[model samples]
Target: MPAITAENQLALPRIERPGPESRPRPAWLVTTARTQLEGEGFQVRRPFPGLEVGIADPFLLLDHIGAVEYAPGEAKGAPWHPHRGFETVTYMIDGALEHHDSTGGGGYIADGATQWMTAGAGILHDEVPPAWLVQKGGLFHGVQLWVNLPASMKWSPPRYQDIGARAVTLLASFDGGALVRLIAGELGGHRGPGVTFTPITLAHVTLAPGTRLETPWRRDFNALVYALNGRGRAGEERRPFGEGQLVVFGNGDHLVVEADELQDARSPNLDVLVLGGRPIREPVVFHGPFVMNSREEIVQAIRDYHAGRMGHIPPTRMDFSHLVGEHIDQDRGGTRR
Candidate 1:
């Protein structure tokens, strides 16, 4: 919530480039429901600790994580790590997350809270379950999205936003159904929350059975609908979409969703996340958490991490060096180096 100093903000140099029309959505990456935490140690899928869906289009990564219940004294979550040249957006539906980052920003987000962190030049952060929430033992549902920073904003100072549910505006309803507008852009005559780094739209929608919702969007930007819960039919093709599925659409000015009558109405609420943005045509050189236009920038990010230039160590004082080293080892074993 602190203001970024002029000196720090001026570090990033601007560059002019083509927008959405120049880069369209490559083939949409349809990742199946694979467990990301399990037997190796924790009770969930092993190797990968997060559920990563969607392609690295203009928006590089999207992780629908922590949408399950946690047990007492059984702590499980993501530890401290470094990131550069991208923005991480965390929207929580239930439970709470205690966050601490290298940039001296730390906070706890309750249910329906949203946190947007821009790891511009670079940042090292940690997200862990609080002791109180672990003891209570309830559901932990949320989404984490990573958007690549353009060349101009790559080195800008890191930023953070803890948005509450009340702060977001809900637009007109469809027969008792409703939509919550969050982040940049508009839907159904209602604008969204947060600053506009790029021309983008992020919305959380809930629809009842037999209800239909229509929203306008830019024709040039690539759009996609991710089903969070329930079953529904989208677009003219009437594609059948279920929970935990991503539906990418071709060029269009709007998106539509119609609920199925046969589907169970006991849990008639369908949670669908709509996200799209103008694509970046520049070459994306990715290595683990850092994403840049060139490999040289990736190397510089690594050097910055080792040199302690990102920021001060997290206040929790937890040493995350071992876990990070193990991750690097695994990536190397898989020929990712």
Candidate 2:
């Protein structure tokens, strides 16, 4: 788990313990994740969207990509695709990935880094392992989340944010038993680097064995806890869940997660992605790469993509014609050869 860490977690700022008035959310539902091949033959563990869309509202999908080691010539990644009316957040924990899009915004994301792409209106997108990583394969672990945009902001504008590893907010549990990395939204008066159209909170937490994490949560937002690795108990009811499992919490002021005392040596700590968002209670029609409110709107998005209404990918080769050396002829006004 290369996702940011602290040698001395006790030295980090502590998240104030939830007061007595704060009620711990109860475990409403729990399910095991399903493994499937995604994007160019890469495998992913998806835990939601299998549940009711209304339950995970404002969130369309969550794909947990490898914590798997790969040999040379075995690495894979997503190819060119189109998206509209939502945001895609790629958090790279252990390996590198190259991202580029029609908006000319992208770069390498690795080692606890994050790339947030808001395909609001529309955009052509591509993300793949770098040639170096592909040629000499190594471990890769990451998460890609699809966040839905409300109908009002669905066509605002396409934007991209490269949130470096160090930019995330880090905090510790009241007793220093857990390390909290805040990727987006607000928590205990501390805010993350990610900006969102919908109110949300995204955090990666590592809980040491036998430690319980009780954190404040917004009553307005839907709460979900997904285990990235290791076994753990969730909510006030203490529902048992393990790797690739997800827990949905009922409305409350706070939530609880406690790591099991006995964990597999493969992953010694319970690492979980804690997330919640204000539900956009509108009708959701998710078809292919488009997330819209109506079927007709989805149809329109597809037609627009085919008609090139979405942005276009830039040419691979650099254009030196605009540079100093390949200047146009002023006398004849001819094109540079």
Q: What does the lDDT come to for candidate 2? A: 0.86
Q: Which candidate ranks first by TM-score, i.e. highest?
A: 2
* Per-residue alpha-carbon lDDT of candidate 1 for residues 20-103, written as tens digits (9 for 90 to 100): 334332223333344444211333211111223323366765556555667776655566667788887877777777888887
- RMSD, every candidate, angstroms: 9.4, 8.9
- The per-residue C-alpha lDDT of model 2 at residue 163 equals 97
**Residue runs of model 2 more than 4 Å from their true location after superposition:** 317-337
Looking at model 1, report the run of 10 residues with the lowest lDDT sum: 1-10
Residue 166 displacement (Å), model 1: 1.0
TM-score of each: 0.80, 0.93
For residues 104-197, could you state the per-residue lDDT of candidate 2 as single tens digits?
Answer: 9999999999999999999877788988888998999999999999999999889999999999999998889999999999887789999999
* Candidate 2 to native Cα RMSD, angstroms: 8.9
